[model samples]
Target: MKSAAKATPAEDSAETSTQLIRDSIRVAIVERRLSPGTKLSENDVGNLFNVSRTLARAALQALSYEGLVSVAKNRGAFVAYPSPDEARQIFAARRLVEPGILREAAARITPDDISQLKQLLLEEGRLMSERGQTARRAEIKASGDFHLRLAEISGNAIMQRFMEELVARSSLVIALYGQSTVSSCGHSEHGDIIAAIEGDDLDRACRLMLHHIAHIEADLDLRERKSLGLKEAFEL
Candidate 1:
């Protein structure tokens, strides 16, 4: 067989730069460092990442496709500011999709899967117990990751993709509408779901998953939007 073509240095550099910009923005948004409706200037992103405007633009375009960024004529790009109606729709979609995901995961999850999940929970508990901005950010990410991990265990590619999008949008919803008093996902509830899955109790797993999601949605202050600052909005 002929040798496979290799990426040139320029191509590799461009790809790396694009991914760096994309991932930085994505993590910033997901971690709530970048708030909704914050303007993303192409120049600023290029400067921040030390890449060309073209690469920064490409990164923002990718995020736009992921529904985490909005691009408008003359407005450049901004972190998405999802409305109350959109929030309801996102949760509604989750309600339909996640129960099925849990059902499959419960049936197929191996002992190793249970072990891995327990480890993740252990780490989550430690992070939640810690104090400071860094710990809180890690906790939030780990909280969402639990559901994403379940989606992976389900062995459904489409459901996995859907869960990825839903979880990302859920971060945006929490940023916009979530109340400070309510935690994202309770550690105890996660433990209960994991126990049910380990026992192959499909119905119980599904029920617990639905209840978990509903608890998160119920914590949102969806009646009004929170005001955000420009500097705090687009820190990256």
Candidate 2:
């Protein structure tokens, strides 16, 4: 699983500090490091990345526009929580939208595209196999980016950007309502979707994409129920 990365000293010198902060936050959001409704203290973030509060504020504002974070007049920036209704809506939109993208990828997919996806999946597998907890987290993050890559290859930059946000937000929703497993991602679905695309079979690609996303949606543990642990209620 792709873990969120702390800002390295080298990256701190990059141009456009605000955008770099924004990208870091985006990775955190995508990798499930920042959960829904978690408060983002501007000063804390600034301190962590060694940036000024002004740069951190700009990054938070950008995330607000992306629908990943919510900003209040007094409460400041916090991770956005999607209500159950919005969760249903976003998943609906993605299922309706992405399968078609897979179809397009099937139609226009170059061998080089398959090669690139293979490389990404191989990295994912390596991280999973080695259990390099930290590297796996980063790989987990990059895995979710596969959809955006597919969209670009499908010849739609606009939808590609939109899919990137949807995929990221999907990670948030799953984190919010899904069971607290160590893995941030399902991890294997990316290769499954790409396999359909590589077969050069559009219908299969559509079906695979739908099935993969449906699997993600079904991962939520919506029931707010739990039993008491031993010694808590019964064993005393």
Candidate 3:
């Protein structure tokens, strides 16, 4: 068989830059630094990242496919501002799938997996006590990682992918409508879920997981907003 042709140097550079811009923006959104409905004009994004507008548009388009950004016909891109119904639907999706995910994870979970999960919980707790945007962001990501990790342990590739998207989109929902700064399930509840898993109580684990998702959904205020600025959201 012939070896595949490699990307040209310029193509490689553009691809790497596009990925970096996309990831940076995704992280900002997940960390709540970027608010829902914040405009992400190609020109502004290009200027902020020091890339061409084409690259900026590419990045935004990537995010749109992830359900994190919304691109308009003539307007441009904005962080997705999930409505109350949309937020409800997101949580419903979680509620429907997480129990099954948890069950699968429980069936396959190893002691090492439990240790890693506990470590994530510990790191999340530490970040909760720390004061700063960085700490808060880490805490939020770690919180989501708890669920993502569980999905990983489940050994289901499709469910893992779904969980990733669900978690990312959930970040957007919580950023827009959450009453508290805390996102995802509560910190203690994570420990409880882990304990249930470790104890081989899959039934209890599933129950805790459902409660955890419900708790997150209950914290949403789900109201409309007037305006948002992308420059401020990016802190650029």
Structural similarity to truth (TM-score) of each candidate: 0.86, 0.80, 0.85
Global lDDT of each candidate? 0.85, 0.76, 0.87
Write candidate 3's Cα lDDT for 1-236 as tens digits: 14421211124344488899999998889888999989999999999999999999999999999899999989999999888888889999999999999998888888888998999999999998998888888999999989999888888877887888899999988887889756546999999999998888899989998999999988988765534466656775
Clashes of each: 0, 8, 0
The candidate that wins on lDDT is 3
Sort the predicted structures by TM-score, highest score first: 1, 3, 2
What's the ranking of the predictions by lDDT, best on top?
A: 3, 1, 2
Per-residue C-alpha lDDT of model 1 across residues 1-236, encoded as one tens digit per residue: 14521211124344476877888898898888999999999999999988889999999999998899999988799999999989999999999999988888777787877898899999999998898888888888989889888888887767886787889889999888888643557788999999887777778888998998888899887885445567767886
- Better by TM-score, candidate 3 or 1: 1
> What is candidate 2's lDDT per residue for 131-233, written digit by digit as tens?
5657756765766767777877777666777887898888778877876454545567777767766666668768877887888788776553244665566
| Candidate 1 global Cα RMSD | 7.0
Q: Model 3 scores what on Cα lDDT? A: 0.87
The candidate with the higher lDDT, 1 or 3, is 3
Superposed model 1: Cα runs more than 4 Å off: 1-16, 224-236
Prediction 2 TM-score vs. true:
0.80
